[model samples]
Target: MPQPAPAVQRSGGPIAPHLRRLLEFVEPGREDVCLDVARGRGPMPAALAPQVRHVTAVDAMPEPPARADTSGRMSTIEFGTGPVRITGDGGPDGDRPAAATTREDRVRHPIGPDRPTIKADATALPYRDNAFSLVTARFSLYTLGDPDDVLRELLRVCRPDGRVIIADLVRGNLAGPERDRIERLRDPDHPGTPSIARLTEMITSAGGSIRRLDVFTVERPIEPWLAGACDDAAADRIREALLDEVDGGPKTGAKPRVIGGELWFTQTWAHVAAEPIP
Candidate 1:
């Protein structure tokens, strides 16, 4: 059997810059308490600890074993020394069996113990109302039960002037060819991605006002990179299919080709500042 992918860390890649951007919006210098919802491996909390008075990292996934790979992309991404408080008990679910899961199951991002985490759902956070000055969710809303409900919960725990930051892939974020592959691989019952308009509605309904809206375009020619990671058989098939796409002629109702090139993914964010309804 092939080795599994290592747990993802906050250290780098397309997501790191955008995550930093959102954190800056919170103005760690001004926020008394920074709460990171679904703070996997505590990377973001670790980043915020020095500036914010306190960072409370919460997530449904349990803390992984000590060996879990939590290293960031680079050595220079400062893993701040401030205290991080986590608040969860359960661990993340293990990969499902082949019969039970798809190719996506093999792509796991393990977590580490840099900060506190909890085994609590986002829609029903354990914190009290108005508990934190800033709440953030990154690349996590897609898996939640009801994103609208989760947004409300974020608002519920936020101080009157606190902010709720949501970041995720917008609809049509992936390249056309890759999107088709993702649609096929994703669970049918998975919550559909929320578009920009849909996200605005969710926040407004949750009693928040949008402050900043930004869309990030992530273009990476990563198929070749990933092809190397797959098993020999899978890699051979992928290579052949890619060649077919490049040689485009006629399809005999077969698996279409996947041209390795600038594949696109979206990162849409909504920063909503919560205010008490007077």
Candidate 2:
């Protein structure tokens, strides 16, 4: 049995550059109510909180053990229309003082307060129809067994004129199956990574009209990528496979290559934005 994927170590840190890129497709609005599915310990809620009216983050995974706060003092800020308060140590921006007068004030101080996060299943979301203007899931599809059901639920909760955004790592047409095999070796719970075409089909089949589709390649070092794997033996196997591929062995579909004496590989990420066809 494969061990669970390791918890994200950069939780609560500044928003990642890759996540920032994904947000471009989301285009959150000030009046929009957003729902982020399978939101792990990501900074999506905090990143979207200031830009949107409200953001509800849901995940099936139980909350991880809290890390000790090095900064002793705690502060609070008002979030959204409701009294959802964000509390954290060391001011809003880690060093700056908290401001509460206007939206501009909130935008300038993006790093304060923990937003609301609910533990829930994605296929069976606990929300009413047409509840949110923007529904999003990032890097979640490969973990789910029934992505089609999850997509339908996303569309079910989105307003008619609203957008449903999905982003995940994809496999190349020829290399996809082999890539998925390696991914499973690293994390047994991983269901396979879908090709871009397959993902688009799933969305369209689930009552979504594609508005925009973007595909980009991200290069990652093998060590950092394997750092999230909980199984040491599995991680070693993946490393060996990539190294073997580099030495002209069977292709692992990871497109592994050595860069300045370190092993590296590439991943294709696809971002799709769709609207519910009402």
Candidate 3:
């Protein structure tokens, strides 16, 4: 039987340069009311919670060990972490199963009530227009079914002067064909990463004025990476691609290496902040 993919816990781990770039771009203020869309474990909530007046974290699904009730709403439980709301998004019935972070580059789960995490869809946000001072999506934008609509929603909930922040993987690390193959093997839901140009175009087209753009790399270990695969075949192909590029190196773009006696690869991410145009 194909082994279940592994969950790469990144929040409680070491910080990567790309994540650092995001922190710099976010620059949450003391009086700012921020909204973090697709709140995973809670990286944005954890970091921005301290920076802003409040951080409303929202995601479609809850995390592991916590299942949704029949009514189809988030159920938060009292625990060691204050309120542990297990979040994930499988489907409407809420049984699809959340995709484990193949590359747990971003931070892990959100921490406290000051950074309240809620389960909701991005396209149909429940906030009024110009509701938040800042809206952000880290590493989760491109994975959505309707990335453009989500972008619009992000802009919608944001105040006219508010900023919409996006820090995500640019589809350039691996060769086009190879990356597609590996991703299909890894997670069927993996909507290939978008290029930096395409992302900017989307933002600007939505009437957002680009404010800040930063690009950086994040290195990921292969052993834990494979755990995100849906099947053994995908795991094998991805491993082989990295191994094939290990000695001579990858001509496509993805650079694979061995560190601490494990195979690894580097991913390029972009941090873009845009404000609603006047």
On residues 158-252, what C-alpha lDDT tens digit does candidate 3 reach at each position?
A: 99877888877676433366655565677887777677678889988877877777665556666565666788887887888778778675653
**Per-prediction TM-score, please?**
0.58, 0.74, 0.72
lDDT of 2 by residue, 1-278 (tens): 52432222234565544555556557678888888765353456666776788887665343345898821111221111111111222110122212212211111112334433565667777788898899988776544337888899999999998988887777655553788888788778676788777888899999998877767666667776676676899999998999999899998887888887888776677778888989
Distance from true position, residue 154, model 1, in Å?
A: 0.5
Compared with the true structure, model 1 gives a TM-score of: 0.58
Ranking of all predicted structures according to lDDT, beginning with the best and ending with the worst: 2, 3, 1
Go through the candidates in order and give each one's C-alpha lDDT.
0.49, 0.67, 0.63
Worst 10 residues of 3 by lDDT: 77-86
By TM-score, the best candidate is 2
Task: List clashing residue pairs in candidate 2.
Answer: 86-113, 87-113
What is the Cα-based TM-score of model 2? 0.74
Q: Work out candidate 2's RMSD over C-alphas.
A: 13.9
Regions of candidate 1 where Cα sits further than 4 Å from its true position: 1-16, 62-115, 172-183, 186-190, 223-278
